[model samples]
Target: MTKVINIQPVTRIEGHARIAIHLDDDGNVNDAFLHIMSLRGFEKFIEGRPAEEVPRIVNRICGICPWMHHLSSNKAVDGCFGVTPTPTGHKLRELCQTMAHINDKILHFFSLQLPISFSGRIVILRFGMSLESLKRRLNLQPRL
Candidate 1:
């Protein structure tokens, strides 16, 4: 017999979602799927908006990766306007994007990867360290 296990409202995520894992007769994994249930309709919302304002509006689409959305929307607007950022501006944008990438990696590592990797065990720190303390111990300066 085959069975399907559904995990709904996946924890620690910003939106509603679920994962379905299928098992075959041998009880081994056979297939899986992820279902995302929320719809923001950003496209319909952004229609008829000024190009300059779209970037700001769309940035709210994803709380976890807002910078990526903002920067991408800015690029699209620039293309529509045939506007090329100066060399300095381009470098600054790239720097911010890189920083966002690093920030995301650090966040995911601590929030998602570490717990799973540790088999959901609570790793105690010597002095009841928090994430801030861990970052400080690692010599990571806050980006902004």
Candidate 2:
């Protein structure tokens, strides 16, 4: 008989999601799926709002990637207004977006990937340890 394991409210990230692991009759893993259930009505919420304010309002779509939402909203508003950003302005926006990407990657590595990767091997420290100590324990070298 086939079986399924459902893990709900996946932590260490924004919004609600779940993971479904399907098992074969012999108990071997068959397939898996990730379901995201966070669909806020930003479209309706932003109706009739000023173009300049839309970016700020829509940035709340995802706490972890708010800059993405903000930048996308700005692009949409720019298209609607038929306006183009200056070269410097464009460069600044790209810099901010890149920084946001890096921030998200670091947060995910620390909060989600590390724990999942070392699920059974992670040691629980009664007293907190330094980042360098933790990296040494994990045998992870700093990457440039």
- In TM-score terms, candidate 1 sits at 0.71
> Candidate 1 on 28-131: residue-level lDDT in tens?
99999999989999999999999999999999998988999999999999999999999999999999999999989877776655544544443333446786
lDDT score, residue 21, model 2?
97
Instruction: Estimate the overall C-alpha local distance difference test score of candidate 2.
Output: 0.82
Give me the runs in candidate 2 sitting further than 4 Å from their true place: 1-4, 21-35, 119-132, 135-144
Q: How would you encode candidate 2's per-residue C-alpha lDDT over 1-144 as one tens digit per residue? A: 689999998876788999999999899999999999878888898988998999999889888899999999899999999999999999999999999999898777765567456543433432378877775666633332
Model 1 stretches astray by more than 4 angstroms: 1-3, 13-15, 22-32, 119-144
Q: Which ten residues in a row have the lowest lDDT in candidate 2?
A: 118-127
lDDT of 1 at 66: 93
